[model samples]
Target: MSDEKSKLLQMVRDGKISVEEGAELLDAMDEPGTKPSGAEKELKDRFLRVHVDSAEAKVNVNIPLSLLKVASRLGNMIAGLIPGEARREMAGRGLDLSKIDFEELMNLINQGLEDGKLVDVDIEDPVKGRIRVEIYVE
Candidate 1:
């Protein structure tokens, strides 16, 4: 174990910190100049990654939560840019973008990351073949 990890474990044993806090602290400690394991790196990332793979095509996207926050703010600022008719049209089609709670969604994602939850989705379309999508904090 790394010295930092060992120290954290020791702290746990000494009752200086709870096991859960020690685990969180140990997870936050990554040695400089050392490559982190995939899961380890993902735990520390501020972006959410969506990776899709299939026989026909592959797509990898990394979306920063910070960018989403900025976009949400910008969208609020430009809400009036969309014509009333267009907004009503979109709402009629059941596509109401204004109803999305971006902040709440981000908060849920952040909580999931903190809880070390992994979500994997797989789809098989007759025409598209097989596709695997992995959404995780990274």
Candidate 2:
């Protein structure tokens, strides 16, 4: 591997920057004449944040998409944040949290996917009462 690429990955692994930042830096390296400036870089580093609110639980997950290798682990952690009752409701609706492919999602984002509110679901849970689940890439 090229030293630049290795260094970029190391910075990501060390939590010095997010995977998106590392990828942008590597892309700048490849071009050798262009770099994401100010506003562009600011937009590139936006996060995918999840918030689940309910009478019984309030969960907030901020995903920086750091290191593609750990995307699944992050997904799992996010899934773990949802309360049991809400998880069951989500599963019954055919939305299996365990199967979410965060790596693919990251690819789409890197390719210049527009950022905005991605998901917002509000429901009445039997145990949790009024519940709302929100997922957004912003």
Candidate 3:
């Protein structure tokens, strides 16, 4: 326990500062040391991370930004094309596909759509997995 830390803790305990204020004080103290260290840069240069799965053999596929736009457009089109019940369902869920950024996710759905395995698609905001697309078969 450094003298300064002990004093800060005492002040917090004595109600001179709130716990949140104490946290902010500690964070403020860190600002002077926030500069990037050269060693960190060197380490980053030496190491890169790649994600992989063993179950499904990886297949390379390129999805253009244009494709995303097209998918979004298609979703909108289907939203209009469907009957009221389907549209209401889509509207209730608020499907929006642009939120899905994981290449694997896109590839899986896209492949499913092409293969007839998926009859519908729904899109949503990425964070909450919101519905963004609704696909249907004739």
Which candidate has the highest TM-score of all? 2
Q: Between prediction 2 and prediction 3, which has the larger lDDT? A: 2
Clashing pairs in 1: none
Tens digits of per-residue lDDT for model 1 on 1-138? 654355446646865445765565454444343334443343333655545566654545443443333224333322233334444544555645455565675667555635332445465556656656454655
Enumerate residue pairs that collide in model 2.
Answer: none
| Tens digits of lDDT, candidate 2, 7-119 | 55775787645688667656655664333334334443566778999877777655543333243555665677677777777887877677878757766776777878766
Ranking by TM-score: 2, 1, 3
What TM-score does structure 2 among the candidates reach? 0.61
Local distance difference test, candidate 1: 0.48
Q: CA lDDT of each candidate?
A: 0.48, 0.65, 0.35
Model 1 clash number: 0
Location of the lowest summed lDDT over 10 successive residues in candidate 1: 70-79
Model 1, position 57: C-alpha lDDT score: 46
- Give TM per candidate: 0.38, 0.61, 0.23
Reference-based lDDT, residue 65, model 1: 49
TM-score of 1: 0.38
List, residue by residue over 54-136, the lDDT tens digit for candidate 3.
12221111112212222232233223333344345544666433333333534443443332222253433334343323222
> Lowest-scoring 10 consecutive residues by lDDT in candidate 3?
45-54
Judge candidate 1 at residue 42 and give its lDDT. Answer: 39
Between the candidate structures 1 and 2, which one is better when assessed by TM-score? 2
